[model samples]
Every structure is written in C-alpha cells, then in structure tokens.
Target: MKQQSGFTLIKVMLMSTMASVVVIGALKETVIQERLTGNFQKDMNARLLAEKGIFTAANNLQKIVSDNSSFSVDDLVNQHGLHVGNGEIGDDTVYKARLSKSAEGLLEITSLGQRYYGDANQQLVARFELKPADIKSPFQHAVTGCKGVNLSGSGVVDSYDSSKGPYSETNRDSSGHVNTVIGDSSVTITGNSPIKGDVKASGVIYLKGSSPIIGDVHSNTGVEISGGGGTSYRVEGNVYSGGFFTHRGGEVKGYVRAVGNVEMKWGSKIINANNDPYDIMYGGTGNFPASYHAQESVQLDDGTTRQNVSYSDAYFRKTPEIEPVKVYDPSSPDYDPAKPNKECDPFELPLNMPDVMEQNPERDQDFAVGATQTYMFTPKIGRLMTSQVGIKKAVALDSKKAEIYLFDNLSQSHGISDTTEERVFGMKNFKVYSDGKMTITGGDVIFLVDGDFVLDGNAKLTIKSGSSLTVFTTGKVILGASGQVITEKEGMTSSGIPSLNFFSSYSGRDGFQVKGASDMYATIYAPLTQVKLSGSGQLYGTVRGSIIDSSGGSGVHFDSALKDVNFGSGGGSDEKSQLIFKGWFFEPAKPLPDLETDEGETSNSDSGSTDD
Candidate 1:
C-alpha cells in the first residue's frame, strides 16, 4: 500500500509540472501577439500623422498663394522643417514637414512622422506646380470715365484689332464704345468728331456735330442732338433714353424710345434702315400734325416740314431699366477711406502699388548717370533708387530680360533739361522731369518708378522688334511735344500695340498730359488722373482715365486685342489659380534629424517635444 501511494504522488507531481509548462507557453504567446498588434497600431498612426502633415502644408501653401502674398520658395527652404501635433494624439505621434524645389522646378513637400514610445515611422512626399491666376480686366471699353468725357476737334473715336494690322479704314470696326459713371451732361461730342461705336452715359448725352454716330446710343437721362448748320448729324442705330429726346436738325436711322417728350424742330426726321419712318415711343405730350401724304407732319421753326413722323404714347408706358454705373463715392460700401487718394475710382484701378514696390529687394547702389555716358542694364542689377536721373545718351538694356525699379520723391530740384515747374501756394516749387531715352534693343524690359515720370524735349523711348517695354509710375506723367514713346522698331510695322504699356497712379488735377506731335504707340492707363490729350499726335492704343479730354485733332484708336490680355493682381488681391496636386508616395522609413525652429533654436525630433 505504501509503494502504491508513493507512485501516485510521483505521478501527481509530474502532471502538475506539465500543466505549469503549458500555461507558461500560452501566456508567452499571448504577450507576443499583443506586442505585434501594438506595433502595427503604432505604424498606422505614424502613417496617418504623415498624411496629416502633407494636408496641412498643402493648405498653408494654398492660402499663401490665394492671398497673393509676397513669398519666395527660398523662404520655405530656409525654414528647414515645420512640425505639427494634435491634442487627441496624446503626445505619442508627431510629424515634421519640409518644403523644397524638385529637379523639375516644381514645389515639393516631404513629411516624416514618428511615435515617441515606439520605433515606428513613416514618410510621404507631394509635388505642386505654380501658375498665374485669372482675373477680370477693367479695360473693357474704349474710354471709361469716372467723371466725364469730352470729344472735340476733327479726330474720331474708333477701334481696330491690332492683332490683325495697324489702324486703317478697312481694319476699323464700330466697337469704340465710350462710357461714363457721372450723372450730368457727362458725355459731349461736338465739332466734326464722330463715334463709330456705342455711347452710353448715366446722365445726359449731347451730340452736336456733322459726323454721324454709326452705333447705338443709350442714356439714363436725356438725348440732345443739334446739327451743325443743318449738315445732318444722324444716329444710324437705335436710341433709348430715360428722359426727353430733343432733335433740332438731324435724322435718326433707327427707332427712338424715350420716357419723356420728343421735341422735333427744323425738319428733324426718324427713319429705319429701309428709309421708312419707324414708330416713336414717347411718354409725354408733343406737337403732332396730320398730313395727307402719311401719318403725321410737323412744321419746324425754320419753316420746313418733316413728313411721315409716327408717334405712340402707349408703347413706352414704363421707364426702361438702365443698369446703374458704379462710381467712387464715400458712402459706398466698396469705398476704402484708408486709401491715400480718395478720388481714385476703386473699380478701375486694380493694382496695389505699395505692395508691388515692396516685393523686390532694393539694390545696394543708386543709379546715377551723366548726360554723355551710356549705361548698360542687365537683369542681374535688380532694383536701384535715384532721386533723379538723366539719360542724354542712352540707357540700353541687354539681350536678356530685365526689370529695373527707380524710387524717388521728386520733391527736390533736379537737373533734367526738359522739366515742368509747378508752384504750390505754401510749398517750394518742384520740377518734374525725365529726359533722354531708354532703348530696349532685344529684350523684354520693365521700369517701375515711384516718383513723377516725365519725358520732355527730344526724349525718344524706343522699343525694338521682338522686344517690349512696360512702365509703371505713381506720379505725374507728361509726354512733351517732341518726345516719342515708340514701339515701331525701325523695320517692323510697329510692334503690336500691346508691346508698350504705361500705367500710372497719379491722382492730381492734370496727372497725365500728351502734348503736340508726340509719337505715342503705347497704351496709357491712368484711372486716377485727369488725362489731357492736346495735340495732333495720333495715339495708336487705348486710354482709360478718370476724365478724358481730347482736343486739337488728337485721335485715339482702340486696340481690340487688349481684351485678351491678363495683367496680374499686383500681389495684393485675394485671387489665385487652383493648385494642381501631383501624385504622392510613401518613402522608406528613416530617422528624424534635428531642425531649426523659427525662434533660432535647435529642436530634436527624437526628444518628443512638440513645437509651440
């Protein structure tokens, strides 16, 4: 019995040892499975963090571009890396993003994510391309006046497509429209001047000339036509007026509609293109005489009679809806009182001069050249400042593209021969001058001036064939009689009108002036100034200003090609093109390196400390 009990104890001891071994093995397997699952979770978390970093960087870049902020790619490269963290991640996962330029010159962002308590990490890279944004241009009309427009002399208002050829009788079209935002007698056409296109005004339109208008006429107020010595000033298209229609001695070749009375005198007639009298719609009572030959006849002041004149009071019972013109008013919600020039039209001027000037770094040296010396400018020279500069010989640009900036106050005295002296009441007299010439031979060049830009005397600024010149100024612009802003290029048939452009921000009374015999083959845009063209010189491009006053046989030919041009937002608008997203990929895991913080301190990624 003792031997059997001893055997049972031995067996029980062996069984218990076996059970302990099995339990220990099972526990070890469970721990190993848990560790593998935990590691897998950490890897996924790191990958998600890396993806978040990419999105964050992309969003920030998009914002910068959309705001039109002045930023350089080098700035992002200098930042080394941008760190990101989340409150819900419990300080275990983080990401570091870096921006750089790829071999193809595209923008690339690389993100690396890590977990603090584990050895898990992930990397991702994305690419993008930069492009110019599309924005609406404000130069939609031949003449856009914030105040008014005055056309006199024998010069005509017409248009031609510069892309096809120069301004000729055959190439001309009736797209030369004139518009004004003012609400008085804002548009006047007198003398022998004729408008080949439409004329639209917010107020009264007065036409007194021998030449006829070949297009439609629209006014929110009244339409008055007075022929010069009964030479027959006619309108070949339809006429719509909100107020009275007065015709002294002229013919309307189309229908006439008015909200008020229609006054006809001295054999004024209304007929359609078929030589048949069209029915007139008038809201007020007017003289109507019956005749045997036709519907009606009216005897005028000159003892002449107009026959076949038909009138109907029921046609225009309600006033026609005319779209209101947007003008610069202080009470308007779009008006910004903080602007320096309050009279400048907000809708017309889209460039932000201050921001544009600040985008480029100022050159270390000043630009001062003697009258007899010639200066060769290249693209490497960048921007230079000068209180005043004189170029009696020539300031030539190299074959490579270049952009030169000249900043000056122009409140001091300068030694430029062709200058204009203006005397202020309480201030010292200042002379504004720009003499000599800047010739662009075989390159595209741009000159940005921060002060008054004047070209007087025999100054001749020439743009050669296959080259272009663009100028932007914030002060007065005067093109003297002998001065020439030419794009003809000796042998070519004038570099298309878009080759030369002048944009000004001057806001004074006579901010821009083009005198006699100046060969100006450039487009002038001075929306904040009073533009005075007093010469026989023909302008071959377009002109947009606050008020346009043309006299003395100065003719303006509009270039229809300007409608397709896209001028940038000048780095101050919230307009941008959509960012194109290139493909992204996961890179091999790598150890994180130390990065420089914005505060000029070194930060370690492995230390697990987040950037503030």
Candidate 2:
C-alpha cells in the first residue's frame, strides 16, 4: 500500500502552484481589458468636449466676421485664440481652440479638449472648417414667381445692368447670360415677346407666337414650342427639359437637352450657336447649376465689377445638373431659410426701421395753410411747400430740406410740450405712426404708417432728384388709378427709386396694389403678401412677395444694383459679405489605457497551495 502512493507530496504541491499562477494571470488580464475599455470610453467623451469647443468657436467666429467688415479669414488665423469651458461636465474639463485660414478661403478651427488638470492622458482633439455663406439678391431676375409666369401680348422681359449708364433694356451684355424669368409652376411666353435672358420653369414651358429668347431655357417638366404659321419662335441659348420636349416651329440656336423624347415638327430648325450639333441631347437628364436661379453678371459703366460680384462663375456652376434646386422644406437639412432666393425662400424682415424725427425743435415751424394757420409739422420746409392738399396742388418733395410730418397716435391726447418722445410720438430715428391718409408731394422724407397706406384721389407721390423717401407700412399699400409713385430724376440710376419695405410678418391677406397710368420706381419687398401691378405704366424695380401678378403690359424692370443695396441698416457695411459653412469633421483621440487606476481593486488574496 505504501508503494502505491508513487506521487510524492512535493510533486502534488508543484502542480497546485502552477494551476494557481495560471488562474491569477487570467484574472489580471481580464481586469486589464476592462480598464482598457473604460479608458476608451473616456477618450470618446473627451472627443465630444473637443467638438463642443469647435462649435463655440465657430459661432463666435461668425459673429466676429459679421461685425468686422474689414477683417479677413487670414486675420483670424493670426490673431484669434478661444478658450471654452465645458458646462455640461465638471470644471476640470476645458477646451482650447485656434482658428486659421485654410485653403480656398475657408476657416480652419482646431480644438484641444483636456480634463483633470489638462493631463496628456486625458486630452482629445477636433477640427473643422467654415465657409462664408453667399450673398444673393432677390431682384437678380426680371421675373421670379412662385405660381406661374405668363408673358402674353407684346410684353418684353429684358435685362440691363443698372450699374451701367442710364437704365435701358437695349443695354445688352454678350457674356452676361442671367435667367430672366423663373417660375415654380409653369411659364408661358406668347405674343411677340423677347426675353433677353434665360428662362427656368419647375413645371412646363410653352413657347408660342413669335417670341425670341436671347438666352437658354430650362424646365424640370417639359418644354412645348409652337411658332404657328407665319410666326418664328427663336431661342438663342441651349434648352434643357427634364420631361418630353416638343418643337412645332421656330429655331433653336443653341443645343437642346431633354430627359424625355425630343419631338420636332415640320420645317423646324436646329441652328447651332457654337457650330456644334452634338450639343443637342434628348432622352437624358441633367442637373442645373447652383447659381442658375440667382446669378447676375453685368457690365458696369466703368467696366469694373460690383463689389457684391465676388462669386466666380464656377461657384454657382458647382450645383449638380441632375438636381439643381429643390422645393424648399424647412425640415430638410439642405435648405437654409436665411438664403434669399426669389423663387424659393421667403424674405426676412430687418430689426431696425428707418428713423424719422417727428419733432425737431430746430426745424419745427408752423406753415401758413388756408388762412387758418394751423400748426403743420415740418422738419425742414421744402421749395414747393404749400397748404393746398389735392394732388393738383401737391407740394413737390424734391426740395433741399428734409420734410417731416407727424402722425402721432397721441397727437390729440398729449400736447406737444407734454408728450414724451415715444415711438408712437416720435424719436430721433422712427417717426410716429400715421392713423389717417398722409400726403406728400416732393421732398426727402421717411413716412411711417402703422395702418393702411392709401394714395387717394389720384394722388401723386412724386420723388425727384436728391430726394429719398422711405415708406414703412404695416397694412395694405393702395395706389389709386391716377396715383403715381414716379421718380423723375435725369441721369438717375436705381437709387432714384424709393425704399419701400413691408414689415408685415402676419399671414393675413394684405397686398400691394399699383394701378392707373402711374409708374412706380421702388424696391418693393412684401414677402408675406401678394404684389399686383395693373394700369398702363411700368414698374422699374425689384418686386418680391408671396405671389406676383402683373397686367399684360405692366412691364417689370429689375434693378441690378439691388444686389448690393442695403434695404435695412443692419448689414452691408461692406458690400460683399456672406457666411458659409465648409469643412466639418470630428477627430477623436486614441485610447491609451493606464494600468494603475483603471483596474478593479480586489482585497481577497488566497494562495493555491494549502499550508502543510
């Protein structure tokens, strides 16, 4: 029996010790792996902190850029460093960021996030770039409508650079090929019309009669061309249609591309503007350029580019041809409501309105009126100051002095001396609200109407040279049949027009109506209302609204200078400015687990070998 126990006690003890070593090593490795995972998670949190820092820096940079017109992106790279605190976490977590100019005028922002006394083990990094948003004009096109645009009768839609000499439609630019008319629904060009610029339609385009277009045509739906008998429909630019294209008569000087079939009628001509027939494409789809909707390149009088013309042709051409534009949806990340497109986005109201002093003691004097000699508010009496009130006896507003009128809500309640200078009365900047009909003949004035603006009895709001009239209305803007919002200044450019801004944010059925034989020279912005142009004369300025309606002969002449005009005093201290977002990326730090503290502490210690 003693011989049977061949295995000694020492051997048994050694085997037990080896097994204990293996188990201890396995537990240690498991703790190390778990510690590594915890460290990795901590690194991710640090990276998020870095990303937050980048966001803070970007917003601050935008504010700085918006405030300082003279500062360039390069200046930020050289002079700016931002330190941001993480409020979500403890105070130990902080981020430092630096901004610099990257390639292609982009702003590069680099942020370093650290925690626990900024230790190297608890740090992360992130980087992103910013691009300035482009500044666009709502008046870049001759006509931009959300419903449909119909050019009937002998109506002519043309383009002329107001930056040139006197404004004339005949002032053509050979290289300036901007879109003349844009309709979200359909476009009908009939009668003997001529469009000197391109045309775009989200639905369909009907080209009948003898209308000739000097530029291209694009349609997301289809294009139907019919010259009829003895009529010639000619198009000088390339034509693109997303759907079927049918040409019955007339000639296309440029190439034609369509996503559907291209049908040609008898005796139809396909002439080439560049001697290339291959430019004609059919049964294929293509994208529209980004600037296809609002790009204006004009030849100025001195042959110098406007300061707002900072964008290159390629910048706008970068849009995909397959899908150049999309129906604006607020929920879409691609859509930016702040970007102003006459065909798409609605206009945003400015914060500050024009300042017109109602009571300036230095210039307040009572003028003689009909032997009654009642007190008439006058900031500075002009040359044609008179007491007669009718349109025939309307005072000419073209005087050298700044004429002022007070339409105070408290004009009767409080005496002039007893009235506190509230906005309802008058401040140094804003004039009091007009409760009743206000009349003006001629003078530089700021008219503020809190209620309906009515030009009764064929009244003429004549604006002449050296005269600047700014009209702010909260209600309907009604112009009578004979009422004329005319600007009569020789050699006057787009600046001759009055600055008319409708600050109505309400969705009510408020509208702007210009009727009769009168002509209007004003930049009309009524994004929440409809704009209707009737009567005989033309409207020579930009018109933006929820819907635009014009009589067949009510010609609309878009002023090119509106691209840079400051409708509100809020911006445009420097003409060319836009806030863009460019390269955005988040980089996370790699996990480097520390063996010291990340592991779980264990108090139980047991030797595998029992004591002898």
Which of the numbered candidates is closest to the native, going by highest TM-score? 1
Clashing pairs in 1: none
Compared with the true structure, what per-residue lDDT tens digits does model 1 show for residues 385-477? 222444332222212222222111011111223432211111011122234444554443455556556666665666666555566667787
lDDT, residue 210, model 1: 73
Best by lDDT: 1
**Model 2: how far residue 25 lies from native, Å:** 54
Ten residues in sequence with the least summed lDDT for candidate 1: 422-431
| lDDT by residue (tens digit), candidate 2, 1-612 | 355665688798999999999999999999999989766755655666666666666666677766554456666655554334553556656555555555665666666656564542233333334443343444556666555566665655654555564455346442222221233467777776677777777778888777787788888878888856444447888888777778777778786666665566665656655754144455433233222211234334566654323222222222224443233334456655555433333333422222332223222322111221111222133233343354232222211222222222111111234333322211112121211123332333444444455654534454445444555555577766755555554222233333333343223463777775766666666655666766666766566555566665766666565565423322232343434655465555433223243244211111111111
Candidate 1 Cα errors over 4 Å, as ranges? 1-33, 69-88, 100-106, 127-131, 135-141, 159-177, 181-185, 191-202, 207-322, 331-486, 490-511, 525-529, 560-574, 580-587, 591-612
| Residue 513 CA displacement from its true place in model 1, Å | 3.8
For each candidate, what is the lDDT? 0.61, 0.50
